[model samples]
Target: MDIPSNHSNHDALWLPFTANRQFRSTPRMLVSAHGMYYKDDRGHDVLDGCAGLWCVNAGHTRPRIVEAVQKTVATLDFAPAFQMGHPLAFEAADRVARLAPGNLNHVFFCNSGSEAGDSALKIALAYQRLRGEGTRTRLIGRERGYHGVGFGGISVGGISGNRKLYGTMLGGVDHLPHTLDLERNAFSRGQPEHGAELADALERIVTLHDASTIAAVIVEPMAGSTGVLPAPKGYLKRLRDICTKHGILLIFDEVITGFGRLGASFAAEKYGIVPDIMTVAKGITNGTVPMGANIVSDTVFDAFMQGPPEAIDLPHGYTYTAHPIACAAAIATLDTYAEEHLFERAAALTPYFEDAAHSLRGLPNVVDIRNEGLVAGIELAPRDAKTTRAYEIFDRAFHEGVLLRYTGDIVAVSPPLIVEKAEIDRIFETIGRLIRQVA
Candidate 1:
């Protein structure tokens, strides 16, 4: 493989989600990836503690997914999905629908998590309007939720930092108070025992806005980017009950939790809460190819089927919707997950992950620890004049042969499902040392 010629030319590339100038001076470069490690430009084998942004659920560079894309591009490089069809797309959608929750029988394809979220929101609103509930227009999100960076996503997303400088977002969006009770739930294992009442905040928002005005309430079943706050015990059930009674739609943004990340195929199944709609990306193609699905229940889907047989049902779709290559990639990814039983692997490894995560309990600056399945988060106390002790730990861990992710003061870890017990120990041990070093 040929490296890009402009090794020193950071000026030419405008990197996304990065501090461009700082990154140019101190760049982290990945030259290759294998199972559970990335070989950096300097040949350092850094263990993957975050599963390549929590998408490579089956580890990296699997032959099946690689071959599928190779075979697909050879046969058909592109297929116009507008008023046209392809077998791979149809087959992949069928496969995804079969695995998707409930009568989430319909699949609308897009390219990324942001697109999946925006598309799901649009589907909820459009379906409501089609059924003559046109007034149900407002979208309800929770504080601290990270629903991608698209216009519709940002509008509903409650991350003030992500939305503050973007100018006024889409109107009629409200947020339920976030469910982060660090005082009560700190260092608790798995789903914290407290804060189950947080779901009831939706009722307050609903009463204030009147349930009829809201099209859907979107949330991560376990908030990931806002620092891995798993939904409190029975909270998801309460949210479901409220949505059921109010005739409101509940949308789970399962982009991060989809596939085998949660030990179950989806967080919906793990929590046993059936949302009316769900948006998924990331693990769809093992993060090998970009793809997303806006999954709608049969009722919501049939709402669009009401008007006519030969007419266009939904007036929205991407030009690359159901791209053949993406479909091929998704199919092979599913095969890889099933053949290796990665979801069950995650379940089996949860206890080891939990122990390793909790081992950081006494480390300096380690304020709290959260763990679920193969994922863990260590919250760091702020350094003076800075709220980012975890960021320092992140950079330090990369240099110490481990890669970690940081959101604010929290360092998150979600190793590939294929991570072994020894690897798990290395992950937390390295993190523990890094935390002590920073403190």
Candidate 2:
């Protein structure tokens, strides 16, 4: 492997989800990463607090995953996904399906969570039509839910900032009210005791839209990108019951919560609420290679299979649907998780992680703290009308030897599942100190 020389010009590349101009001015570049730490360009060892954007569950650069990618690329670099078959693709799909709950036994591979979102939506809409309910075209999502950036995802997604600039996205898309209730559930541990009735909003939406017109309701079991809002206790069960009653398919965008992030194989298993379709990525390949998948129940897959034997059941797919390298990485990643028992490790660490996170309750400008499993969110009060305090803390924390993620006024902490007790303590203590310094 050859390391490329450091390029002096940063203007050639535009970073995603970043203030590019601000980033170019004083760049914080990571040169390498391993285990729970990243080495930045300045030769500083930074603690990975957010697990590289909530991915990298088994930690970074594990030998098995790295070797798999290298060996697969050299042996079978690219395989056409449209018609050509590959043994690795089938094996990988089987592995992922076995981890999923219930009859979610079929897998559709794609390149990222964004593609998985669009793919899942298409599956729901097509499944409804195949079952002779073609009128079911409307899709539902919740406020502040982040479901990647595809047009289909954005239409169902409820973040105003992500939607406003994109113009009127897909029609017949509606959103349920968000579950974040600062006054009622602030600083609560695990799932908040209040706001369970928020799921009733789905019932209201069903009434307003007429259940016949709705195809699916997509949501994150534990909303991650919109600052880590865990589903209220009983909230998911109510949604599940309502969707089942109305004949609407339920989809869980578990890109952030899948693959042991919630101390279970997936949030569906953790909450015991199996969705009709589930989108997963990030941890699928341990963030080593880009891969996402839509795992559907047997009922949904069977509906599409009723057509002619030679016919293509679903017309949607990506060019890199089951890229050979990605399949190799995913298989190795799953192997790492099982061999190391990382999921059980994460479950054991949840209580300690939660306690460490809540220790910032008394810090200045700290408004609320919420957590579930291995993830947490520390929300800060706005300095003015703008929400830059969290970003400031994030920047300071990076310079002070910790890497964190900031969205709006909230900073998220989701370290690798392999993180130790001391590293967890260091992560929160750094944030606690930085919160005061920024204030």
Candidate 3:
């Protein structure tokens, strides 16, 4: 494979969630990737530590996914999603629904996690109206929660930087207090013991706004993008109870936690709590293709089914919703997961991954370490108020032949589920050595 020339024009694209100026000054480029590693421009083996931004659960460039995508693009590249259908689209929906928990038997397809978030929110609002509760238009989100970048997602999302420039988002949107407490739950493994009471903030929000006005409450079960803050023990179940008591739909934005990232098919299955509506993406097609979905329970799907025989039930979808190639990739991806027993493999590797992550404790500037399943976050005490330490570490790690992710002075390690124990050690070892050198 030929690497793009370093001297090539690099200003034509504006990268998302990246420092474009700094990247242009010194670009870290990858030419190719296979199982567990990426070949950089210089042809160095860079071990994947974040699984290509928390997707690619299976790993890079798997044979089945590649072949499926190739065959699909050749035969049928595009298909109209509105009032039309394809066999692969229906087949993909069936595969995803079978893996979902409970009676989450219906799937609405989209192109990315952002679209999935917006679609799930719209479905909740529409379901409420269809059930004769048109006044239930308010949406609730939690502090430090990350859904995606869509207008509805940003409105319900609580990341300050993601919301500050957008100005006042959708009206009647409220946020529950975040459950990240390093002081109380530092160095904890799996689910933290404290902060379960934080879920009661939902009840308070319900009292303040009244249950009749709320449509749904959306949250990330592990809060991956906000630096891997796993939910407190009993935290999710408490929220589920409150939402059930108040008749508000509970939406789990499982974009990052879906498809074996949490050692199970989804965070819902791992935690034994089923939300009314679930938005999923990322690993649905193993990051080989762009695809997402909103999986809803029978009750929610049935409500929309009643008022439509000849009429369109839902008046929303993207032009590429369930595109033929994406559907083919999804079906092949699900087949790969089942045939390889990757979910069970992830479950078995959790202990080794967790121990490797926690071994980095007591290192310089390391403040807190929290991990669950295969995902871990090592938060550093900031060198300055700007929180540049982790970014520095991330930059150094990439050039040092390992790739990692950083956000707000926190370094997160979530390798592909196919990673071996030795690869897991290498990821943490590189991260540890770099953290010491940064300060």
Candidate 4:
């Protein structure tokens, strides 16, 4: 095989959330993808085990999405989303709102997960102030939470590595203790039997900061990016109750778990919980385009609606808020999901997936395994102090024809909803081999 080369120097790009030097040295490049595999620049078919960063729920290059973009580009590619409006944009939002849980009937569009997070935080702050809670400026996040890299996101986000470089982020942010207790919860299957009491940490924060000044609490119904940590049994319910009692908004950052990763349409629905707002991206367009959404309830939307029309209800949005092409892709993605019944497919396949996922329990160095719906997290012991065994397995799997995602020592596999039983077998089989070979 010939060594691949970038047309220009790769260092100038300055990648995000990446080890630029390490990645540029041993670059893994993909040229095309279809169904459950990606054709790398080396012309090797790499099986997808992470659903392309937990998006691409429909898999890659679905014909509906391809055709949607093809025809849309010719008809109308770029249109100003500011003062001007488009029918496709409204149609997509209307459909999305209907699918989202509760009276989450209002949708605000942006370009990515970070934008969605920042926008939702702003909405929470602005909503409280608009409704006479102007003093409520504090935001709450859970430790180990991953809410993208925007300024407001970094403030409420709990990842130390993602925040340490940015200096003191937006102040007045408090964190709920993350519910990943490896000692009591190790090797647990599905939701852990213990740790429901961790939700009371919210009350402790409330005692110290006072709920009157807290604007919102944002958490991933199932935390991703910082490894996969599901909310403990009954934990999410208690959080919702506390937020209700204190008049603080609850925002579910569903950027990864939304769009059927959890079997249902969103984690909010899968777990029987609803939030004041939901931030979604990734699977919304099946990773075909860059788009995200801040889903708000009718109450929140109505609060903003009361102000003067010319004054602007909520002074937030991007120039690409509702780009015509993105709207077209999203509409087609939804239609494809309906035609294929992908969500129902994922739900039905969960038992099979869970069985296959948990079968890795006794592998060497394996410490824990957790699975719910189509998502699985296989954790291994660290090789050295601050060394990530997960990354080792990830590299081996990718080099051996499977693409899996790793954060520290945890390997997260949430394949596209359209994945077949054979592909699921392949994913785990590759992972099992990689685990036994490393160290």
Task: Please provide, for model 2 over 5-103, each residue's C-alpha lDDT reduced to its tens digit, 9 standing for 90 to 100.
Answer: 666579779898889988988899999999999999999999999999899999999999999999999999999999787999999999999999999
Q: What clash count goes with each model? A: 0, 0, 0, 0
- Give the alpha carbon lDDT tens digit for every residue of 145-224 in model 3: 99899889999998999999988998999999988998899999999999989999999998898999999999999999
Off by over 4 Å in 2: 1-8, 385-387
Question: lDDT (CA) for every model shown?
Answer: 0.89, 0.94, 0.93, 0.90
What stretches of model 1 exceed 4 Å from their correct place? 1-8, 385-387
Candidate 3 overall lDDT versus native: 0.93
| TM-scores for every candidate against the unseen true structure | 0.97, 0.97, 0.97, 0.96
Question: What is the per-residue lDDT of model 1 for residues 359-413, given as tens digits with 9 covering 90 to 100?
Answer: 8898887889998888888888876754378888888889878999998889999
Model 3: runs farther than 4 Å from truth? 1-8, 385-387
Error of 4 at 356 (Å): 1.2
